[model samples]
Target: MTGGSGGIGGAVARRLAADGTAVVIHYSGGAARAEAVVESVTAAGGTAVALPGDIAEPTEMSELFDAAERRFGGIDVVVNTAGIMRLAPLAEMELDAFDRMHRVNVRGTFVVSQLAARRLPPGGALINFSTSVTRLQQPGYGGYAATKGAVEAMTLILARELRGRDVTVNTVAPGPTATPLFVEGKSEEQIAGIAAAAPLERLGTPEDIAEAVAFLAGPGGRWINGQVLFSNGGIA
Candidate 1:
């Protein structure tokens, strides 16, 4: 799992671990937090390890994958929850910020997905992260949405490309999720308003997104391929 130290990624790790799957948690930073998650999983009698690498860098990511395979013998599922969000209208957004988001979100997903496609055996699944903002069409999300949109497009096509491989490639788009990354710059009023926009009347928890990811990476979602699943509670 990339971005394993982030809110949604961490939740997915724990959730998958709870299902008796050995997990490899990948983090670009926040080594301490990743270790904490690893400890948590082990404490609960689950198998897990923390690995660090830049998901956007193929060589680094390849080494990371090699390490994971060596440790676990093989990889079955790849969940790429690594992404960075910077909110700004297209006119006001800095090119640097846009580039960085693309590097981590779009390029990162591409690198991970490529490795997954080449390495994963039959029945393996690659789950990528996207945001419901692409559908919401909200202001200040142009760049972030663009990055996620690319992810959606790539995942959809990759699934078809792996037609006979028995591998599923899918994207999970979460809406107004209550992760620290989503709440960082928003005020309480802003959050409440966004939450209320959904009929569920609350922001989605990390676990909610994790459930969607777990389903896609698990046996139940084998028939689901080349699809973009909106896991939001009817927000879009």
Candidate 2:
């Protein structure tokens, strides 16, 4: 799982490990945080290893996959949850910020998906992260949503590209979630307003999103491919 150091990624890693999958936790930085997650997984008697790399770099990502295969014998599922979110209206958004976001979000996902396509064995699954904002049509999310829109498009086509290989490709688009990345900058009112947008009347938890990922990674979701599963609690 990429972004294994982040809240949602950490939850996905732990959940997969608990299900007896040997997890390769990928982090761009935060070696310490990643190590803590590994320790937690190991303490729970699950197998895990932390690997660091820039998801946008082919060489670095290849190294990560190499390490995972070396340690685990094979890779069954690849979940890319590592991404950056910078909100600004299109008019005010700096070109540099937009480029950085696309670098990590769009280009990064593409690179990882490409590697997964070549490396993953039959019966494997590749899960990419997106956001509900694409459907929500929320302002200030233009650039971020564009990247995710590209992800969704790529995901659909990749599934067909891998046809008959029995390797499923899909994207997971989550709604507003209660994570440091989501909660750090918003005021209580803003947060509450977003929470209320969902029928659940609350922000999604990291674990909530992880559950959707686990389903896609597991046998239960084998029939699902070339689709974007929205885990938004009716927000869109």
Candidate 3:
């Protein structure tokens, strides 16, 4: 699990561990937090390990996968939840900020997915993270949405590329989740307004998104491939 140190990624890691799956928590930084997650899982009688690497670096990610396989024996599910979001209208966005977003969100995803394609055994699943912003088509989200759009496109093509391998690849696009990343800069009124747009009338919890990811990584989602599961609560 890449980005396993973040809010949604931590939730996903914990949930998977609760389901009796050993997890390798990958983080770009936040080593202490990642270790905390690993300790929590172990305290609950689940197996987990914290691994740190640069998601955008192929060599680093390759080492991560190697260490994970060495620790767990084999890898079956790879959930890439590591990403950065910098919201700015296309016209106003700085080139550096846009490049940074693509470096982590697009390039990072590609590097990990490529390694997974080569390493994951048959019957494995690869779940990439996207955002409902693509469907929302909101202003100031063009750059972020473009990165996710690239992820979606790569997911579909990779699924076909892995034909007959029984390895499933899919993307999960979430909307208005109440994670620190989403709630940090917004005011209460802004958050409430966004929440009200969803039919559920609330911002999504990290666990809600984690549930969708757990499904795709488990047997119940075996038949689901080359698709994007929108866990947006009908906002889109």
Candidate 4:
């Protein structure tokens, strides 16, 4: 289940469905947009259902997962791309923003991952989203980086927790993706500058990140457990 139905989450859901996995595409708002994604999947001869929920709320998340069970019968992969990013310096960050960030990015991930790890049929994989800012230490991204850092810290430990079950928990950190989420308040020039920072001399794409996710969700990445795969086009 991913958040913000418009960008990376949409791409991930589509790519996974294309790989022949029955995808349960989760969203909070943007019902129309979510349905559009499902339509595309079905049109392409894949199975998918749009399940909506607030990742920050346990009851909502429960309903979302329940829908997955009702439709697919057995859970194989859980990709968590649901997240929010509100920028502010440490002093300017609001309590609400901090609370919201942790609630969704940290607590929400725990709720989703815990359930998946415990209930996944063998060969299941859990994929969580992180950010390269955790490594770049970009200014004004203090709180955002903290949430991703927490995700990274939990990814490996969860693998150990589920070792006996053969379930794998890992994290993906992308750098400078051209998702609508990143262009919210930036100027075109500012966006270009950030793109230039990557070694590939271009911004990342949702498909690029989704391709990595499909790998983990598929058989080839079965042996890759507890890893933080960075799909950032060589961006530091």
Candidate 5:
């Protein structure tokens, strides 16, 4: 899992571990946070390891995947939740911010997905992360949404490309969630308003998103290929 140190990513790492699947928690800069997630998983009798690498770099990511395969003997499911979000209207957004977001969110996902497409064997899966903002069409998210839109676009094509490989390529798009990623810059009022926008009347939890991912990666979702699953609690 890439971005395994972030709020939603960490939750996904633990959730997958709980299912008795050995997890390789991948992080970009949050070493301590990633280690904590691994520790938690091991404490619960699950196997997990924290690996650090730049997701946008293929060589580094290839090494990371190699290390993971060496440790676990093989990889069955690859979930990439690594992304960075910077909110600004397209008119006011700095070019640097836009470039950085795309570097991590778009290029990074592409790099990892390419690797998964080439390496994963039969019964393997490639799960990528997207955001519901693409459907919400909210302001200040044009660039960020564009990155995820690219992810969604690549998902279906990649699934088709892997036709006879028995591999599934899918994307999970989450709505407003209570993670640090969503709550960092927003005021309580803004958070509450967005949360209330969903009929569920609350922000989604990371675990809620994880459940959707777990399903897709597990046997239950074998037939669910070439699709984008929105785990957004009816917000969009």
Candidate 6:
């Protein structure tokens, strides 16, 4: 399940569903946006259902996954793209800000991954979202990066722990992308300036990130495990 409907998670859902995988689109808020994602997939001849839940709560996650299984028989692939990002320097960062990022990015990832690793079929795959800031060490991203860093660490260990289960766990780290979150609070020129920072000289599209996710979840990626595949257009 993914969080916050119309960004990277939505793109991931659409791409996977298009590839013939029925997707369970999870949303923390914005029901209409979530429905739009589901509708997009359905219009393209793919099956998808949008459900809302708090990824940090065990009972809520349980119900979410149960509902998914009921709709699609079983979940063969789990994607924890549910997350929140905020901008603040370490010195000025409030405990609540740090906790908020960790709550969704770290705790949420662990909760979904734990369920997938234990209950999914042998060949199932679990993918999580990290960020390129973990590599570049951008100043304001200290708190956010710490949370994703936690996920990256957990993802690798989880892969080894799932040894014989035939489950592959990995994280995808993306650089600055032209998503709502990236564009928010930025002027057109400022957005252009940030986009130009990447070697490719352009901001990433959600589809770019989704394509990477599709590879990791598909049969072709079964042999790949415990690795963070960076798809940041060489930015990091």
- Give the C-alpha miss distance for residue 43 in model 3, angstroms: 2.0
Model-by-model lDDT, in order? 0.94, 0.93, 0.95, 0.86, 0.94, 0.89
With candidate 3 superimposed using the best TM-score fit, by how many Å does residue 80's alpha carbon deviate from the native? 0.2
- Give lDDT tens digits, candidate 2, residues 149-169: 999999999999998899999
Once superposed on the true structure, which residue ranges of model 6 sit more than 4 Å away at CA? Answer: none
Per-prediction TM-score to the true structure, in the order listed: 0.98, 0.98, 0.99, 0.96, 0.99, 0.97
Which candidate model has the greater TM-score, 5 or 6? 5
Q: In candidate 5, what are the lDDT values of residues 1-236, reduced to their tens digit?
A: 99999899989999999999999999988999999999999999999999999999999999999999999999999999999988889999999999999999889989999999999999999999999999999988999999999999988899999989999999999998888777887898998898899999999999999999999999999999999999998999
Estimate, for each residue in 125-186, the C-alpha lDDT of model 1 and write its tens digit: 99999989999999889999999999999999999999899999999999888888888878
In candidate 4, what are the lDDT values of residues 1-236, reduced to their tens digit? 66637689889988988888888888877899889989988899988888888787778887778778988787889999988887899999998998899988999888888778777888889999999898899888999899999999998899988867878788999999998778888899999999998878999999999999999988999999998998888877
Which pairs clash (backbone N, Cα, C closer than 3 Å) in model 6?
none
Badly placed stretches (over 4 Å) of model 2 are none
TM-score: which is higher, 1 or 6? 1
What's the lDDT for candidate 1? 0.94
Cα deviation of 190, candidate 2, in Å: 1.7
Candidate 6: worst-modelled 10 consecutive residues by lDDT: 1-10
**Higher-scoring candidate on TM-score, 2 or 5:** 5
Q: After superposition, how far is residue 124 of candidate 3 from its true place, in Å?
A: 0.4
Candidate 3 lDDT trough over 10 residues, lowest sum: 177-186
Off by over 4 Å in 1: none
lDDT of 4 at 76: 86
After superposition on all CA atoms, what RMSD does each candidate show versus the true structure?
0.7, 0.8, 0.7, 1.2, 0.7, 1.0
